[model samples]
Target: MTRPTPAPKPSAPTGTSAAHVPLRWVGPLRISGNVAVTETEVPLATYESPLWPSVNRGAQISRTVDAGIRTTLVDERMTRSVLVEADTAETAYAAARAVHDRLDELRAITRATSRFAELLAVRHEITGPLLFLRFEFSTGDASGHNMATLAADALLGHLLAQVPGIRYGSISANYCTDKKATAINGILGRGKNVTAEILIPEAVVAARLHTTAARIARLNVHKNLVGTLLAGGIRSANAHYANMLLAFYLATGQDAANIVEGSQGITLAEDRDGDLYFSCTLPNLIVGTVGNGKGLDFVQENLTALGCREDRPVGDNARRLAVLAAATVLCGELSLLAAQTNPGELMKAHTRLERLTGARDAR
Candidate 1:
C-alpha cells in the first residue's frame, strides 16, 4: 500500500490590503476586489478524421481548432506559437501573414487545408536559458487537439530546422489542467478531493454581497456537476449552466468533451468589510468559432449572435465565452451564499418591488 504525501500548505494571498469602505462588496461580486479576465481566439479548418475516413473530415478539424484555442489561453501570459483560422486557404495564409506583420517577427507557417482552410501561428520569446514559444491556431471544428498538436509539431520542426541551436523543452500543453492541479494541490493534502480553505480579509466583504462575490480555493463546480450527472444524479448548482454552455460549444463546432476537465478550480474569499469574492478558473476550455458544425445554419447564427466573425481568430471568441462563464459562476456562488445565510430575503424583496409597481400602475 502506498501512503499519500501530505498536501503542501497554501500560502496566504500576498499584497492583500484592508478594506476602507464601510459597506464594501469584494471578491468576484464586490466592486472593490480587482479581478482580471482576458481571452484570445484562433481559427481552424475542417480536416479528415483518423477514426472514420468515409465521414466528412470537417468535424475532426473543427474539434482540433477548439482544442488549440483552449491551449493558447488559460495561462497568465501569452507565448509564441499562436494559431489562426479562416474560410479559405488564401484567407488563412493571409491571416498568418497579417499576424506576422503586426509582430514583425519571423514565424514558420503550416497549412492543413486538404479538407478545410487553416493556419498555425507562433511567437517566440527568450528568457535567459529558456525559449518560450506562444502558439495560436485554428482547429476548424470538433476537438482539434490532434490538429493543434500536428500544427505545433510541424511548426516546431520547421523552427528547429531554421534555428539549429535552440534547445526546446516540453511544458504542460493544457493551461487549465496545470494551473488547477497546482491550485488543488495547495488546498488538499496533495490529492485530497474535497478540500476547503478560507480567504481572509477578502472573505469579510464576500460574506455580505448578494452577487457572486465569494472567493473559492479549490472547487471546480463544473467538474462536480459532470461527476453528479455521470453518477446518475440530478443537475443542480451553476454546473447546469456549465452544461448548457458546453452543449452549445459541442453542437456549434466547439470541443464539448473538454467541458469535463475544463470546468475546474475556483477562488472564493472575503474581505475585512464583510464583503465576498468568487472567481472560477477553467484551464481546460476548448472552443472554436469556425469549421465542422459551424457550417450548420443554426450554429452560424449563434456565432453571429455571439459577435464572432469569420475573419477573426476563433480563440478570441473562446476567451470571451470563458470569461463570461467565469463571471456567471461567480454570480451563482454569490447567490448560493446569500440564500444559505439569508433565506427568502431576495424573494421578499422581489415581492415588495412587485407590490410597489402594481400600486403605481393602478394610478
Candidate 2:
C-alpha cells in the first residue's frame, strides 16, 4: 500500500498574528470569536486532489515540489486609481503627479500596518474632459484595494483643494485595471512578481514522473509556447498555475477574483546537462496577509499554519506569501507537465481522486 506522507514544508511562513476588528455597519463593530492560530509547525500540505474537495480548507498539500528549487523576489508594486473631470489632460496629470512626487519625497515607504501606502506611480489618461489617474502605491500586507481606495479619496480631496479646476469623477475608474488582465499591469507590473526555478535530474524525472528531463523541456516549448501562441494567449502559457493559486487563495481567503491577475504568469523549462531547468513567473499576485478574511478561523488558521503571519515591516509578510505562492504554482506546473508527458496518469489520478474517492466519501 502506498500511503501519502506529510508534505515537505518548502520555506513555509512563520510568526503569530491576531486581530479584533469590528465589522461595523454604520455602528460599532464586534468580534467573531474565531481566534485562529498556528503555533510552530507549518502546514505546507495535508493531502488533497485537484477537484471534489474543492474548498481545500483542510485538504492535503502536495509533497512533490522540487527539493532543489531556488525562488527570487523580482518585483512588488500595488496600484489605486481615480477619475477626474479637469480642464485639460496636462492639468490633471500635473495635479496627480505633484501629489505622487510629494508622497515620494517624504519617502513614506511603509514597513508596518497592513495598510501602509507608499507612492509608486501616478498614471494618467485623457478622453475629452475626462482625465483618469491611476495612483500606484505599495500597500504593504493587505491586497490593498480598500487601502488604495482610501488613499485615492484623500488624493482626490488634495486635488480638489490644491490642483484647481479638477472635480471628482470616480474613486475607482476601472482604468486602474483592478481585477483585470491588462497590458498596463503587464507593462507597469502590478503586485509581486516571484520566480521559482529548479534543475531536476534526468534519473529522478524518469523515476518519479516517467519522463526524461529533455523531453519535458521540449514539451514545454512545443506545448506551452507554440501551442499557446497559436491559441492567442496573453502573458501566460502553463499547465495549471491557477490551479495551485486558486487552491491556495481559497485556503487563505484572498480575493478570489484577483486570480485574474494571478493567472497572468509564465512557465519556462529548458534542457540542461540531462537535467531540466524550469521557472515560473507570477505577476499581479494581489494577495494580503492581515486583512480581508485573514482573521477568520479557517483562513487565519491556514495562514498561521503556513506561517504567513509576519506582520512587521508592513509589506514583508505579503512579499513572503507571494514568494510561497509562486513556488507552489511552480510545483503544480511541474507536476502537471510531467503528467502530460505520460498517457493516463492525469486522468487516472482525477478519476481516483475526484470520482472514486469523492463518491466513496459521499457514502
Q: All candidates' lDDT scores?
A: 0.36, 0.64
Candidate 1 per-residue lDDT, tens place, 252-360, comes to 4555554454444433344324333233344434555554556755456545644554454434554444343333333434343344344575466546656764576
Model 2 agreement with the true structure over 222-301: per-residue lDDT tens digits: 99989988988777777667666765576666877888878878889887887777788786787889777776665776
Q: What is the TM-score of each candidate against the true structure?
A: 0.38, 0.77
Candidate 1: how many backbone clashes? 78
Against the correct fold, how does model 1 do in TM-score? 0.38
**Global local distance difference test of model 2:** 0.64
